[model samples]
Target chain A: MTILASLLKRDLGRFLPGTSSGGTMLPLLFFLAVAMLYPFAVGPNPTLLAATGGGVIWVAALLAAILPLDRLLASDVHEGFFDQWALRGISEEVVVAVRLLAHWLSFGPFIMLAALPASALVGIDGETLRIVELGLLAGTPGLAAIGIIIAAITVGLRSGGAALSGLLVIPLAVPLLIFGAGALSTGGDGGLALTAAISLLLVAIAPFAGGAAIRAAREG
Target chain B: MEPFRLAARDIACRRGDRLLFARLSLALEAGQALQVSGANGIGKSSLIRILAGLARPFDGTVERAGTIGLLDERPALDNDQPLGKALSFWTALDREAAPLEQLGIASLLDVPVRYLSTGQRKRAALARLIGQQADIWLLDEPLNGLDVDAVKLCEELVAQHCAGGGIAVIASHQRFDLPGMSTLSLAEYAL
Candidate 1:
C-alpha cells in the first residue's frame, strides 16, 4: 500500500512539471487543436470524419505519452534511484508498474480530452462515442505498460529512437488502433464490445512485456 | 535474526562489453561495514549495483541483508517534487531530516531540485539517507561534493547505522575516515 502511494506520488512529481515546461505545451495543445480541426483540415465529411477520429485521437494520445517516456527512468538512472530501489528489496517490476500507472494517469485523461470533442465534431453517435471511451478505458493502461519499457530502453539513447521506437511499437500497437477504431466505428450491437474484450486480453500482455523490458534494460 | 542474507558466489558485472568485476565475494554481520575500494573503472560502482540487485552479476554471488539502501554517485531526486515529497519516496528516510533542512536547502524545499547546485544536490541526498533508517547502507562515492560539515553529518549517520547493528558497504577511492570500518578491495573480485 505504501509502495503504491509512493510510486504514484513519485511519478506524478516527475511528470507534472512538463505540463508547464518550456515549449512542450505547444505540441500537446496543437495535438488537441488538430484533433478538433481534423474534419476541417480534411473537409467536413461526417462519415469520413467519424471513421478517422477515433484512430486519430488515440494515436495522438499514444504520441503525447511518448513525451514523458524518456524521463521514466532517465533521471533515476542518472541519480541511482533504480539501484536504491533495487537495494531496498522493492521489486523493479513493482516500481515499473507504478511508473506506468502514473504515466497512464498523466496521459489517459488527455486522450479523453482529445477524443471527447473530436467525437462530437466527427459526428460519432452517442453509442459509438461510449464505445470509444470504453476502448480507451481498456486501452490506455496498456499504452502505459508499453511506454514504460520502450521509454526505459530508449530514454538514454541518442538519434534514431523516434524511428526505432515507432517501428518497434507501431506493429504491436496496430492491433490496438484497429480495435480501438473498430469499436468507435461500430454504431450499434457494438462490434466494439468484441474489440473492447480483445483489448482486455492484449492489455494483459503489456505489463509482462513492459516489466521484462524494464528489468532487462536496468540489469543489462 | 539479523535479516539473514545469502548471495550466489561470484559477483560478475559486464557493461557495454567491458567487464567491471568478476567473482567478488564479501559478507557482513550486523553492525559491520565494508568499503568497496578500487581504482576508477575497476567496477566499484558496478559492484554496488550488483549488490543492490539493480545490475546482474556476470559471475559470482551477492548475499543481501534486509532493506539495503544503495546510494548512487548522484542522488536520485525528482527535481520537480517538493523537498519533502522527494525525500519521502525513498521510504528509508526519517521525516525529521526535512528534505530541505538537512541539506540546508530548506528555503528551496518548495522549489524544484533542478535549480540546486552540485553541492546542494549531494547534501539533499545525504539528508535522505539520514531519513531512511534501513538495515544496510550501500553508498557509491558518498563523499563527493560534500562540504566538511556535511561529510561529518554523513559519517555520523554511518556510525549510527553500524552502532545500531545495521550494515554498510561503501565504495569510494577516498578515505571516509571511520576507524575499524574495513575495505573490501575489488582488485581480487575482478576477472
Candidate 2:
C-alpha cells in the first residue's frame, strides 16, 4: 500500500547509514572496531585467533546491534509521529513491522559485508568466514526484532534508557548468539537451522509486542 | 465533510494516584467547535487524548464517527530534515494539499525544522493538520508560542475547518475566540 511505502521510505531515510538521523555507520564502525582490536588485545596467535574469532564476531555483532536501539523507536514516540500514524488508521503493528524491515536493511547486509574484512582482522579461516556470514544473515533479523521491541519498551524512560536497552538486549540475544556462533565450532547445519528458526520466531513476535509497548507508552 | 460526531459519556481521568477529573462529558456534531480550558495540570490534555482515542479513560466511554487528527505540543516532524521534506513526507501519505502559503510558512520550507522558531513550528503543525483532512481535529494548546497575528490565523483556520463541516476540539488555557464555539472549563469537572 502507498501508506506502508511512504512509512518505509521515511524510516529507511532515517535509519540508512550516512543519511542523518544519527548515521547508522556508528554501529558498523563499532562492529569493525571490535574485530580490528581483538588480534592486538590477545596477541597475534593465529590459531588462538582462529579458534576464538567466530565467537568474538558474534559477540561484536550483538553489541553493534545494540548501538542503534536507542534511536529506533524513542524519537518517533517522543516526536508524536506514532500518534499521527495511529490517527491515520495505521496500526502500530504495521509501523513496527515496517520499521523492523528498515532497521534490518540499514545494518544487516552491511554487517554481513563487513564480516569479510572483520574475518581477516580476527584471523578466521575461509570456511569459518562463510559460516559467519551465513550465521549473521540468519541472526541479524532476530537482532533487529529484539532491538525494536526493546526500543519500544524503553521509549518512555528519559535518561539511562540507552544503557538499559543495551543491557536488556544482551540477555534476549543470548539464544541467537549461541546458535549463530555454535555453528562455527560444531561445523553443522543444525545450529544454523536453529538460529534461523529463532530468528523467524522473534521476527514474527516483534511487531505485536512492540506495538503494544508503544501504545502503553502513550498512556504514560 | 461527512456527518461526524464525538461524544464522551461521564469520562473520568486519573493520573498516577490523583484523580484529575471525573464525571466529565460532552458531545459535538458536525460543524461544531469546543474549547477545553482549565488551570495547568487540570487534565485538559488528558481529555483531548481520550477523545482522540490515544489514551483510555479511567471510567466511561468515548464514541465517535469519522477519522481524528491531533495537534499537540510536538510538531511530529523530523527535526533533522528541512521543513519542506518533512512536510512532504506527510503530503505524500495524506495525499492532501496543505495551505502552506496561507499559514505564512511557504517561504520557510527550506529551513530545517529544528531551526524554525516556535511560532513557525506551530504553523507547520497546522499545515500538517490541514493535510490530514480528518473530520475531527483535537488541538492541545494550539496557540502556544504564537504572535497575535498567528493566533488570529489559527483561530481562522479552525473556524474555516468547522465551517466546512469538520469538528474542532481545542484544549488550551489561552483565549481562543471563535464564533459559535462553546467552551468547557475543566475545573468544573476536577476533583
Candidate 3:
C-alpha cells in the first residue's frame, strides 16, 4: 500500500500540470485552440455551430489526449525506471496501472473543466454542455488506457514513434468516440452507459497489455 | 543481509539472429565478488542483465535467493528534477535515506540532473543503489565517467559491500580493483 502511494505521488509529480514535465497546460491549451478555431473556419452560424460543436469537442478531447501519449511511458523506460522497479519485485502491471491513473488525473478532469469555456466558444447550449461533460467523464478513462497501451508498444521504437502512437490511438479510440459523441445526438442514457462500459473494459485490460509490452521491450 | 546465493547454469544468450555467448555458467555465495570482463559487444552487459533477471536467457536457468540491485548506464533520475527531489523519490520508496554525503553529491542536491556532469550523475546513481541496500549488486561499467577520486571511492564502496556479506557482480572492460574479486571473460564462451 505504501509502495502504491509513493508510486502515485511520484507519477503525479512527473505528470501533473505546470510542473517540470510541462504536462498540465499544453493539452488544455490545445483543446481550447481547436474550439476557438472552429468558429473562424466555419464562419458564424449559430445553429451549425451548436449542432456540430459537441462532436468537435469530442474530436478535440481525443487529439488532446494524444498530445501526452508520447511522453507517458517512453521517458520512464528510457531512464531505466521500469528496470529498477522490476528489480524491487514490483510488477510492471502495477507501475503501468498507477501511470494510467496519473495520466487520467493529469488531463481528464481538467479537460472536462475546460469544456465550459470551450462550449461557449463553440456555441453549445447548457443542455448539450451537460451531455458533453458527462460523455467526456465516462470516455476519458478509455482514452487514457489507449494512450498508455500505445505508449508502451511504441516506447522501444527508434524514431517516429510519437507520430505512430498518435495514429494507432485514433482507430482504437473510435468505439469510445462513437458512443461518447453519439450520446449528444441520441439524448439517451444507454449510449452513456455503453461509453462507460467500454471505458471500464479498456481500463481493466490496459495494465496487463501494457505490462507485457514493457517486458517484451526489455528483450529488445 | 541474510544468507544470499546467485547461480546461473548452461546459459546461452542470443541477440536478434546472432548468438552472443553459449554454455556459460557461474555461481556466487554470500560475500563473493565477480567481475565480467570482455571487449565491446562481447555480451558483458547482457550477462549482467541476465543475472539481474531483467532479460531472459536464450537458454538456461538462473537461480537466486536475494534481492537484486542494479546500476547501469542510465542513472534513472528524472533529468528535469533537482537532484535532491529525484533521489528522494527512490528514498521514499526504499524507506531509507541515501548516503548523499558519502557519495559526494550532497553539494549537488539543488542542481537539475541534466545539468550535472556525467561523473556527478554516476555518483547520484550510486547513492540510489546504496539506499536500496539489496543483497546482490549488479553494476555494469560502474567506473565509467568517474574521476580518479570517485573511481577509488566506488571501489572502496564495493569492497565494503562485499565485506558486509553482500555480493557484487561488475561487468566492465575497464579495470575495477577489489580484493578477492574473480574475473570472467565472455570471449571464451562466445558462439
lDDT of 1 by residue, B60-165 (tens): 6677757766666567877666655566666432324444455576776666667777777777777776666667787889988878988887787788788888
Question: Could you tell me the lDDT of residue A191 within candidate 2?
Answer: 96
Q: Put down candidate 2 lDDT per residue, B104-165, tens digits, no spaces.
A: 99999889999999999999999999999999999999999999999999999999999999
lDDT of 3 by residue, B30-96 (tens): 9999999999999998999999999999999999889999999999998988999999989988999
Which candidate has the top score in DockQ? 3
**How far off is residue B116 in model 2, in Å?**
0.7
Chain A, candidate 1, TM-score of: 0.79
Clashes of each: 15, 0, 1
Model 2 C-alpha lDDT versus the unseen true structure: 0.94
Q: What is the per-residue lDDT of model 1 for residues A72-103, given as tens digits with 9 covering 90 to 100?
A: 66556656676566555666677776777676
Candidate 1 has an lDDT of: 0.68
DockQ of the candidate models in sequence = 0.53, 0.82, 0.83
